[model samples]
Target chain A: MRSPGSRLRATITSYLLILPAGAFLSVVFLYSLARLGYISVHNGNTGLEGPAQIDAYRFIVDDPLFRQAVKHNLLLLLSVPVVTVLALTIAFVLHEGIRGWRLYRTIVFVPYMLAIPVLGTTFVYLLSLNGMLNSLLQTIGLGSLRQDWLGDPSYVLGSIATIIIYHELGFGVVLFLARLLSLPEEVDQAGRIDGCTWWQLRLRITLPQMRSVIMAFVTLELITMLSWVFAYVYSTTHGGPNFASSVLELYIFNDAFSFQAPSFAAAAAILLLAATTVLIAIQVKRTSVEVNPE
Target chain B: MHGVSKGARRGWLLALALLASAALAACGGSSDTPATSGGGTTSGGKVELTFWYWGEDDAPGANGWLASAVKAYETANPNVSITVVPQATDTFTATFATAAAAKSGPDIAAQWATGPVLTQVWNGAITAISDLVPADETKHWLNTSENTYNGKIWAMPEYLIGVPWVGNKTVLAQAGISTLPTTWPELIADCTALRAKGVTPFAFGNDTYWTTQLMLQSLSSVDDVVQASIGKKSYTAPEFADFEKGWAQMASAKCFNDDVSSVPMSKGTEQFAGGKAAMTIGTDGNVRAWAKTLGEANIMLGKWPTYGSGPLKDYYNATQSTSYFVTSWSKHQKESAAFLVFLHSAEQINAWYAATGTPPADDRFDTTKITGAIDKQLYSFNTTGPQVWLQNFFPPQVDGNGNAPAQQLVLGGQGDAAAAATTRETAAAQWRAQKPDEVKNWSNFHPGG
Candidate 1:
């Protein structure tokens, strides 16, 4: 049996090895978070010169813009399922070894490799009222399908979600495909030997095995829908056409930078961070919800 | 006089950098920065002053003029070195705010006049120009009253710009309209006349929201805007709310472009530049730009139609476009002040007008030196009377959240004037709820006093 002293020594060694990365994270992330928390309550001055209160929180609660932003974030959550299904279908098809599977894989992952700003700027022009998207629709005799893709309030958020899905699809596909390729070939052979149809086999066996990977993807995407959509929205619409596409991050940005109201922005940011923590917590404990079809 | 040509180059990297910069607004960060106005120099006696400016988008040759001016100033004062950094419209306020929080930024920075400048001053970001520049010199500066707070001028005016209704005479004649609008009823009749000829009238972009300046014609003074923002008065009142009806009427009359909400302000002006539309409201610099594009003879400049019975209704919409100010933390405040004073000298004044074709904000500049008839008219518009840029009087929050969105509501065909008024009132209440100290500061603010 391992001695208690030896175990303690090993634990200390592990901690010592982790110290650099842990310290780095604490300085970069935790420090910023603490500073953000301070800015939230404290009024703008040389720090403690002014009274610190929850005035920022009160302001955000009553702000119709803030409410609209939160609503848009919730609406974007609907895109998570659509992204997962699309990624899974693409990954599944490529894993099946279609004739151009290698080439298709390369094409699928290319967008993920492109810088997000480049994609956003390109799509903004392509989606404008007189942009190439509408022109192409006209040429293809699909003129009726052309709407004000980035202009209309009713459609702007959906358009942003669509852009994000297009950009994010490649990352999800590559991750799922990597997992599928690592699985045992014997498992598929056994399914075929049992006279299982391709569809039935995927539904009964393949999907069940993918639960862990799927969980990881869904979690990342949930966090993404919550925190990482600022670039897409800012570059394209700047949370505009009357804050129709405003997200929590953009609201924080405007409150901080544009409106000269960083106190309010800091308040919104702390709320966002707390919500993100709850998301990570849910993902970590997801083992309890795991299902076994067998 | 805000000429912001905010381009679309932002992405994840940009936002991440901004967030990182924002974190520097921490209480801990300010103490370590150049918060104190220490000496500006290296080991030698030479002084380097950094000037952050924004103008090229509105005034085409401003960058070139600045480069020449910098070179000239350096040659004249051998011991002084100047570095000029241009600012973008979208990032201007945020960049300055980030610098302000750290208490370390430019020796000299340019700002949009009045509210944008005073907001920073209230943040303790600026050193009052009255303390830096001599009274005799500052007395000659036009529109100095706009930047004055508590009887001290916080910033120096550089150039004058006015919001003029720019019409393409060729396009107007094509629509069978020879005269431009001077009153609300006449403007509506003109919109109908242009629509009958299948010409789009009153082209506007609402995403950036400055076009709402037209609504300012309904109010008499900056105090009215201040009172509404602090909840002393309702935005739903007839004086503050009535102009929204004009926007609603314009929207219903199909006065704006079909995609007004989606496009940037640049795109909205592009339609006018391309002669695809009849008229747009633009700065004096924009008037010069349009004159170049559509030929000087094809351009007509006039006041925004009289929309309300307020005393300011007939006031010409012209004022200083941007202000030059020394940072409170600037080490070379004296040298910075010297450079600002040189900007108003007769040589620099003539050079400024020659290069940019926009009027320099100095009373000493001879009006006869202005060549173009349009230039002469724009200048006259600026000097005519007490023009109210109602947007400037609004807190940045109310301008962005209330006035901006309310205009977008009408342009998108989503709401009426009443709804726009309610939106403005809600934004004012939101501001008051968030910033008690600012509310107090605004209450102390008497524009006339």
Candidate 2:
């Protein structure tokens, strides 16, 4: 062990080492958060002379579109589980050394690597009414299944969610595959020697060991669905066919940029941040308990 | 022994510091350069001016005309050099807004006709173009009221964009119709006659909601719509109901293309361009564009069919398509005004007309330059019967949030007149709440002599 003075000196050095990063965070992130909080109460469109109004918060809370946007985001959360399971299943298959697995992996991961606006635009064209998807369906004698994928309010949110899942599937697969590849081979060998079936080995050993990774991915997906879908919504439907697919971020943008009501947008942003933070906290707490029951 | 000697280490650190300094300088170089660029007089004492504009993609040959105009201006005045910044459509407004807020944008920037101009003027971001250009010259531009504020014109009108109903005469002839519709009854009959022969009467991509709103504007007085926007008249009034009923009549007649709702406005408008639909109503820009596809001889342009029969029946949905304003912070206002005046000159206006086929707002743009019959007719209508555009008068939020979607809802059969009207009123109420000052200063505009 180091002497007391030496340990103290090292401690001081560590503090000195972190000072730059701490100062940066305080100035950039914490300062912005503080400013956002300030603007959330004050009118953001006006100068300092503008009166403070808590009514901005009240207005957003009462707006039906705000409620609708929240409901749409929550509904899209359903895609998280579906995406997670589909990715894990595919990753497991790839890990089993399936034929052409490398090519398959590359093809599957391509969408995640592509820019969101490009993918969203491509999907918009493909899913449009006179687009190739519908034309192909009609050609194949599946004409009855033809629907207005983007125009119908009932299905618009679902369409956006579907696009989100399709884009995010590649990311989830890559993440799970990375973890699966790094896992020990001995556990699988031991399970096989103990007469465990393939299904049993996966369910009993592999999945249990992957609990932490799965939880982390789910938390990430949850956060993403909450905050990271503005481009898809903007480029595709523009939150329309009558505000059917309007998300919180789109609402904030419309308020701030379109309406010139930056105060209301600021308040809405705070609510979105608070809601996402609460959900993420609950997920993190649940994950920690699962990882360490003692 | 493995470590570098003390001298070598110091040398390495010095090199690292120099590299960091270079990187910092590189980053600083970009932001330090003002968006409008430095504009002090050159060593030869020539003034440098910066100009920014958007919409080259949508208005195909605008950039070419602007560049040629700049070259012409620079050649004529050897003491001046102009730099034109063509901005992307999506980021133009927001970027300008940010730059204007910082008081550090281009000396001259293109602005949309009314709402955007009004917002900028309200914020005191732009100088009145009238202050630069003479009144005699300013009086020649069309729809000056749209950008007029506080007894002065805030922007220089560039081109006139009229919303007229254009037709593919070949498509109409194929449907056994020889003449264009001129009256409300004739319009309905035409819709029926075309549909009976398995042709859509109108091609509408209802995504932008212009399909329904433009039709409504055609069927009603433009003044009523403007009054309704500013709370002087209600959308639930009898006139709007009649308009809605007329829209329902067209909807029941199946006037639109098969996949109208599913397609965007641009894609839907293609039906007419492809000769699938007999007619479509749109801005003069689209009309000029379609003229390229369906030969100039095959295209026909006319005012919307008269609904009730009044002066408004003859009025065109006319406004300055876009305008340019001198920034309040510009150091070279006089030099910038000189360039602005150069754009309105007979030579540049002719070049603008030749390149874009858009009628220049400057009356000096010779009508003899127009070769096509349809182009001449459009110019005649624009020069004679301009009317206030309802879309341009509303606050951006009101038009975006209420008008666009409510029309979509109504056309989709999900809402009625009362519901759509209520949405409009609510949007107006929101606007009023947000900008009571603008509302108090609002004055209803009437167009034409």
Q: Which candidate ranks first by TM-score, i.e. highest?
A: 1
Give lDDT: candidate 2, residue A108. Answer: 91
Candidate 2 local lDDT, A168-264, one digit each (tens)? 9998889889888888999999999999998999999898888878887897788778877888998888888778889888887777666656667
Question: Each prediction's DockQ?
Answer: 0.31, 0.20
Native contact fraction (fnat) of model 1: 0.31
Q: Estimate, for each residue in A1-294, the C-alpha lDDT of model 1 and write its tens digit.
A: 999999999999999999998797668666666766776777662244465655778778777788889899989989999999999999999999989998898898898898888888888778888789889999999999988888888899999999999988999999999988987788889999999999988887788777767876887788788888888998888887778899988888777767767677778877776666566556535532463222
Flag regions of model 1 displaced more than 4 Å.
A1-7, A132-146, A287-294, B1-43, B98-104, B329-331, B366-369
Cα deviation of B99 in candidate 2 (Å)?
Answer: 3.9
Interface RMSD of 2: 11.8
Per residue, candidate 1 scores C-alpha lDDT tens digits across B1-449 of 11111231123223333344343334223222343233369778899888888988767788999999999999999999988889898768777766777778789998888888987898798999999999999999998988999899999987888788889898889778887988878888888888888888877776656656666677766588788889888999988888888878888888887778677777777889998789889888777888988999999988888888866667665668678899998989999999999989999998999998888888899889987898888888888777656567788888888988898888888888888889889888877877777788888887851
| Fnat: each model in turn | 0.31, 0.21
**Residue A261 shift from truth in candidate 1, angstroms:** 2.4
Error of 2 at B421 (Å): 1.9
Q: How much lDDT does candidate 2 score?
A: 0.74
